[model samples]
Every structure is written in C-alpha cells, then in structure tokens.
Target: MSEDFKKRITVAQADYTKSFIQNVFLQRTIFFLVFLILWQILSSLGIYPKFLLPSPIEVLETMFFGFIESDYLFAILESFRRVLLGYILAVFVGIFCGLAIARYKILDNTIGASLTALQSIPSVAWVPLALLWFGISEAAVLFIVVLEAFIPSALGVRTGVHTIPKEIIRAAQALGARSIDLYIRVIFPSIIPQLISSLRLSWAFAWRALIAGELFVNGVGIGQKLELGRSLADMSQVMSMIIIIAILGYVTDDLFFRTIEKKVQKIWGFNK
Candidate 1:
C-alpha cells in the first residue's frame, strides 16, 4: 500500500477504536440512568415502604448529610485504616508463606494443603473464633481480615511459582545466581503479574473480612454504621453506606490494582 493510504487506514482504525470505547461508556451511563429512574418510580408508587426501600435520591441525600452531620466520615476512615493495615500484613505473610511452600516439599504437603482447605471457609465463619480469641476488639477484626486475605494471596503466589518456566531458573543458576539473588532478580520479577492479581484478590477478601469483623467488633467503622442504620430502621442510611462501600471498592480496584496489573502485564509481555 502507498504511505498515504497506510496512514489513512491507521487513523481510521484509531478513530473506530475510540468511538467504540466512547459508545460503550455512553451505553453504560444510559443504562444506569434508566435503572435509577425505575427505582425512583417504584419507590414513589409505594411498592415498598420508604423506610424499607429508600429511593436513590434519598440515599444520596443521606450520604451527603451523614458525612456532614453524622459519624459516617469517621466510620469510613476507620474502616479504611483497618482494611489497609490488615491487607498489608496479609500480603507480607502470604508472600512469605507462598515462597516457603513453593520452595519446600514439606511445607507444600502441609501448610499449602491446609491453606487450600481453609480457603473454602467464608470470612464470616471465622468471626466467632476471632471474638473469642480477641474479645470483640480491633485485634479480632485484624486477625479475621488477615486470615481471610492471606489464603488466596498465598495460593496465587504458589501457583505462579509453579507456572514459572524451569529454564529461567536453570539459566539463573548457571549465571551464579544464589537463593536470595535468584528470588529477587528472577522469581519475583517473573511473578509480578500474578503478585498483582493476588494482591487485588487479597484486598477484596480483606475488605469483606474487615466489614464482617466490624459488624461484630466494637468500634467506629463503615460496617458498624451499616449495622447502626439497620438497627435504627434507616434504609436511606443503609443504602448510602452500601453505595460508599461499592464506590470505594470499584475505585480502588480500577485505579490502583487494575492499573498496576495492566502495566505489569505489558512489561512482562503478557499483554500487548
């Protein structure tokens, strides 16, 4: 093809791609708007009591006023703090355990097997044990969060390690790479994409565990606020907290973990 013709084709393809993306976004926005309108109409028609099924506008208002007039802001901050601390600890523990399990046959047969079984348990199932061990304190919540988050992370890392090309390890060994050096230079870099995915999964688990813990533990937290709303028969407040939680989860995944995952995949040539 001529240079001019090739350039036109390239531009046309780029424009088409951009238009497709924009259209998808626009369709989503329209769908969301339609959903909200239907929700409002149903609530207005009294299909359910206002206190039981608050409209979107009422929820939005509650979210606004709750932040301004209530302890919602403090609750959110407390929840975020607990989740962050727990998630960080889980990442460290998970990575260490994962590496050990992957490296040692004994650990692989023991702890790795145990983790696989433990992963089947729901985060909330650990709440009673946590309460007994820590007496409904922050420690109890952190414990649950860490336990819930670490399992998937450790498993993901173990799987990643197993999937690593044996040739790379042999190449590194031939180059005089030792234990720590091999891990730092070869193993870790090779597992970046998997690590990122594991971290994201762990964060989600941590988030759920944190909320479950907070619902039972004593403290200011989003989960506590949600419980409070339920107790007080305030549907608007409950919906508001739900929306806030959803927004935080979505933003965190999209902006941080997803962004990092994409970059790492590109760097590792897993994506183009």
Candidate 2:
C-alpha cells in the first residue's frame, strides 16, 4: 500500500477510537459511583428515614443477604426466562406481520395508518384484558410483554423493507430474483442492520412490559419482589431490586447484541 493510504488508515482508526470512547457507557461508571458516595453521605447524616431512602450499603447488603437467605436468585432467573420467552415470541410474530403488511399494498397503507395509534397504547393497558382472557397465570404476563415488543419490531421490519432503494430492487428483479428469492437474496440482507436496531428497541419495550406483568401476575420475579418490599416497607430491598433490573437490562443487551451491532457497523464502514 502507498504511504498516503497507510496514513489515511491510521487516521480512520484514531477517529473510531474517539467515537467509541464517547459512545460507550463505561465513562458513566465513575459518575454513578460518585452519586452513590453522595447518597451514602446524606444517609449517614439522617437527611431522610432509612426505611424511606435506604443507604447504598444497606441496599447492597440486602441484595447479598437476601439472595443467600431467600429465593431471590430463582426470582431473577425466572424473570429473565419470562422476558426472553416473551421477546422471542414477539420477534417471530412481528416479522410475520411486518412482512405481510409490506407485501400487500392495500394492507400496507391500511396497517401503516393504524400502526401508530395501536402502538401508542401503553403496554400496561393490556394487563387487564390479558388477565380477563388468560386468568391469573403466566399467559397474562406473557401477553402484555409480547404485545409491548411486537409493535415496534413489526413497524421496524416493514419500514426497513420499504425503505430499500428502488434501483436495488429493480436490479435484483432484472437478475431473475422474484418474491421469496428476491427477499432472501436482496431485501433481507439490506434490512438486517435496521432489524438489529429494532430488536434493541423491542428489548426495551419487553423489559417495561415484563415489570408490569409481574406486578399483577402470580409469579416469582422482580416485580413480585418489588411488591414484597412495598408490603414490608423495606426500602433497601426495593432499591436493590431496581439496581438489579437496570443491571440485567444493560448486561443482556451488551451480551446478546453488542457484538453483532458492532460487526454490522464495521461492515457498513460506519463507526467501529
């Protein structure tokens, strides 16, 4: 390679490193620790009742001791299971519905018109109907979680598919690619980046829906634990549960999608 070309590559690498540092959440770690330190100081000074706003130390202790002494670990695992199951089902159904709407012009416009209105309804609004239809069981919880995630994903896929450049479609069609084959060879690949982005949004929706479901449904999970803390007026447990939920959400997204997202960006010659 030429010397100038090598210099360009080094510049690009430096730019990418700078972007990564700005975009990643690692920088917020110390900021949160500082916040915790301030919280502990206030708690020590008795600015508020411990039961109402427990200290950070108390919250950590509650998480450690509660899990060791009780079924908290199982509760967390069950919660993760429920969220994953609901999210998977949502993705499947969403992809089907999205593709159908995108395929048929009449349905495309019709559903597109109503999609926003339908999705705008909060996930929690379905909880009552879910209970009525499925009773006080896991189904009720699952329904709300699925409903929450499905809307965004379906919309995402349809939008992604629709947004493909017309020239690309025409060229693929000219090459004898038609219908399913066209989609497999051209459309699907083009939409993958968008699909990944949408799935991340879907996870956010599913997380919110899961908490709402667990609060009403008879289940052993974070929502149930939150309720238990409320009944006993245990602020430490409540705080700990909140932190655990936040941690899990962050961890799961990083574990499952971060690698793929970065790879896609790299492939697209975006920030990497």
Candidate 3:
C-alpha cells in the first residue's frame, strides 16, 4: 500500500530466504553422505571388524533384503501405532494439566517446579516402575512414552499461556467476556504457537522413550528385533534398524510436525 511498507516486506522475504538457505535439507544430505563415505572407507580398511561395525552399504543391503524376504511393513506399522497412541494421549492430558497449572498461580508455583525437576530425569529411568506396574507389555512402553511426552508439552502450554499479554486479557474482560469465552476466544488462540513448538520436542521424547521401553519389554517391535540382533551378533541388522529408526523420526518430524508448525505460524502471523 505504501513505498516503505513494500521495502519492509521485501527485506523480510530476503531475510527468510537467507536463513532457510543456511540450513535444512541440503546440509543434512551432505552430512549423511560424508558419514557414509567415512564409514565405508573405515570398514573396507578393516579398522573395525565388519561384524562389529558394518558399513553403511551393508546395512542398507540388509534392510532392503529383509523387505524382500517378508513384509517388514508390519513392523513399521506396529511401531508407528504404538508411538502415535502414546503421543496422542500425552497431548490431550498435557493440555488439561497445563491449563490447570497456568491458570492457578499457587498450583503453578508448586507443581510447576516439580514438573521441571521431573524433566531432568531421563525417560528411561521410569522403565523399572513401568515394568513393575505393567510387566513387559505394551502398557509398560506406553507408560514410559506418556511420561516422556507429557511433561515438556505441559510446560510449553503453561509458558505460552502465562506469556500472553496481561493487557489483552484485561481488555477482553472489560469487553464483558466471560471466563470460558476469555480462554477459548483470546487465551487459547494466543498460546497455539508455543503449543505447536512443543509438539516437535514431545514427539522426539516419545520416540526415544518408546524405543527404550520396547528394548526392555522384548516383544514384537523393532526394538525387540534390535535386541535379537545384538544377541545373535547380527551387527548389520542392528545398524539397519537404527537407520530405519532415524529415517522414520526425521520423516515424521519434517513432513508432519514441522509442516504443521510452519502453517500454524504463518496463519497466526508470527512467522513465515
């Protein structure tokens, strides 16, 4: 609409482009390829025994071959299902707990400190208790995952709610907004950005916790396969499974969570 406004928009676009160029896909690909090359070189020279440290190519071959032998697809699907179930439960519960803590200062001051302290405890630490309660089952894995996923999300939502401008809340109240309407119409919308930011963190925690629990449970999951690989001294299978887990984590985070976050931020006019 104006010359200065047009210049500002152009500058913002250029800055975003520059920042995007400095990070993201190409850099990740380069690093992955370099690591693979180094791995191959070291393996070929026998710096480490092939049984102990299979090359990237060997790992890839084993993964591909496994697919040919049978539908490894089910393993992928099952792993995904467990992670999703635990993560979704955490999201719902976290929102409620976060609202309670953030809306009440006394609760926030007391439980908030405890939640922060709990976060410092690694998710794996809960496995013993979880196993004692649920006994080497999906329930145990889910319990660990929920513990990992819920805490950061709850903290994020609380922080986001607290950070909303006090003037905005007062103005909405002055406009005769009721408490429920105030939260739904004003406060919730304001905190969506921070909530979205925490989803990425929550998913990562869920992933790691899922793997840890699965490893302990020794059931029909990829983590169990990893344990089997270790027991059989099948380094290739172990490496292949690790690669699969990494790829799955990256794809889900990048394609789903990150894409949703970008869209949410853009719609909220917070970022581009």
Global lDDT of each candidate: 0.92, 0.88, 0.88
Query: Which model scores highest in TM-score?
Result: 1
Write out the backbone clash pairs for model 2.
Answer: none
lDDT of 2 by residue, 1-272 (tens): 99999999999999988987886476687679899999999999997888998889989999999899988899999998999999999999888878888888898789866877888988889989999999989999999999889888888899989998899999999999998999899988888887888888889899999998998877799999998898899989888889999888888788777778878867856663
Best candidate per lDDT, number? 1
Residue pairs in steric clash, candidate 1? Answer: none
Model 1: how far residue 190 lies from native, Å:
1.4
Q: How well does candidate 3 score on lDDT at residue 99?
A: 93
- TM-score for each prediction? 0.91, 0.87, 0.87
In the range 174-226, model 1's lDDT, one tens digit per residue, is 99998999999999888879989999999999999998999987779999988
What TM-score does prediction 1 earn?
Answer: 0.91
> Candidate 3 on 1-272: residue-level lDDT in tens?
89999999999999988987788777778888898898899899997888998888888888998778844567777878999999999988788889999989999989888999989989889999999999989999999999989988899999999899899889999998878998899998899989988878899999999988888886577787788789999999888788889889989898888999999999988885
Model 2 misplacement above 4 A: 1-26, 269-272
